[model samples]
Target: MKIAFVGKGGSGKTTLAALFARHMVETGRPVLAIDADINQHLAAALGAPAEEATLPPLGEHLPAIKEYLRGDNPRIASAAEMVKTTPPGRGSRLLRVVEENPVYAACVRPVGGVRLAATGAFTEADLGVACYHSKVGAVELLLNHLVDGPGEYVVVDMTAGADSFASGLFTRFDRTVLVCEPTLRSVGVYRQYASYARDYGVALSVVGNKVEDAADVDFLREHVGADLLTWVSRSAYVRRAERGTVGPLAELEPANRAVLARLAEAVDTTAQDWDRFTRYAHEFHRRNAAAWANERAGTDLTRQIDPDFVLGPSALSAPVAG
Candidate 1:
């Protein structure tokens, strides 16, 4: 199953993303958790250390390419080189290289023995591009890498806010679960986001994050409608983590675990549908699994959705413009 969390900032989005990753791992799925946000805080919230990489943000290349394409003085390299360096393809170039102390090796830390790979920090270019424009575009490319990578599940803790989530990357995943607090602002954000998701290709859902009361959950439900799927109660652990407390959440805070389990169920449920990226993934899995079913049936084929049929009911809703 592949999913992403998107909503406005200060709505506990990073925390929601971390918990979702942890929950997937705990449930025995090999998960690829990505910090697609350029702010690069998801890893830290997930208790993974942030490392500094020298590569540029993928977004930076676009504008640089734009500038260079327009004959402006630009540092962007050739498209072939860009494709060669990062390669754009998920498993190509730097992403697929094997190494001792591989960044993602630790990024995918074990929690009760579940494997997870995540980006602990942004590359130099990633940071610059994030600061410039197209932070969402950079994230989309990064997710393309992870979707190309091997994993049963992919969970994205999107950077703080709705715009980034609404960008193309959100549509790339099978499910987009908006995490929001219960304040009036959050409710408004949830409504706006749910409406947007309906228009985009994302299967929009709402999780009442930091739920503290029945009324709060109901309040979210009133606005989110069918988009509202789960509710996560408030937890001291969330508070502790907010202060920089660290490590895998093997202890499984009750509030945290409850919502995570719901998210897990949501992820599992969404895996069965047709979506934009699902078809390509399905084809990849079909061939790979076909090869393995003969000799490697035990191989994992979870992220394998077919993007060939990214049409019909599964397509994300489009935005209703003025």
Candidate 2:
């Protein structure tokens, strides 16, 4: 299952993402954790060694990605131009999750038991004109093409706010956990995310973070109501873990552990709507291309999504066509 964690900054989305990935790994599942956030701190939160945390962002390696995925295909201009819905054509490549391929080896790193990948941080050089959407595109391409199995899990820590909606990346996940705090601003983000995601039939569940007592939980229940799945109280252990003073997060409070387990069960059991997902992906790709990419890049990239390519549950395993 593919899951994403999204919420306002400082609402502890990354913390929850890391904890969930670690929990999956400890339970003997193969997991891939992607830091799609611009802040790029999921590695540290996952307790990766300093060297592993410094692995370059996959976005920075466009040429190699194109070579590995597209081979000698003349149709693709370059990897940088590939969007979330870019399909593989006759000469293009395909990726099976955790496969022994050069692209996977260069992009993913092993940290403890879970594999980690990141969308590199934005430098000052990207000051005014550069769009973070390019970095997001790299993540989109990876998720769009990679075929995940039943037991394998992919958890992405998405960039904060509604910016991710600019692309169809939000539709790629089976479930999205909105890490909302007991505050108006946090609940406001949930409102914005839900408004956009509802159209795609995306399954959204709220994880109330930093709750102090019954009143805080009451506030969340009042605001989120039926969507609230679970809650995590503020913890000193989490703080120490953030500060690098703790080892693996093995001793989570009993309540928090139970909540995490429930979250995992919910994610694993939820049925995926591939038909809705495919329709929304195509719809957003057209919207984004016509509104921006075509005018800006002088090419109708939307032409790349092949009409004959059927995107069903089995399409994930089938070879892609451009």
| Highest lDDT against the true fold, candidate | 2
Q: After best superposition, candidate 1 residue 7: deviation in angstroms?
A: 1.4
* Candidate 2 off by > 4 Å: 49-51, 71-81, 88-92, 295-298, 316-322
Give the clashing pairs for model 2: 88-322, 89-322
Which structure among the candidates has the greatest TM-score? 2
The lDDT values for all models are: 0.53, 0.80
Estimate the TM-score for candidate 2: 0.91
- Candidate 1 vs. true structure, TM-score: 0.63
For model 1 the local lDDT of residue 153 reads 68
TM-score for each of the candidates: 0.63, 0.91
lDDT of 1: 0.53
- What digit string (tens of lDDT, one per residue) describes model 1 on residues 162-233? 665323445567778788788888878877766666755567778887787888878777777777778877
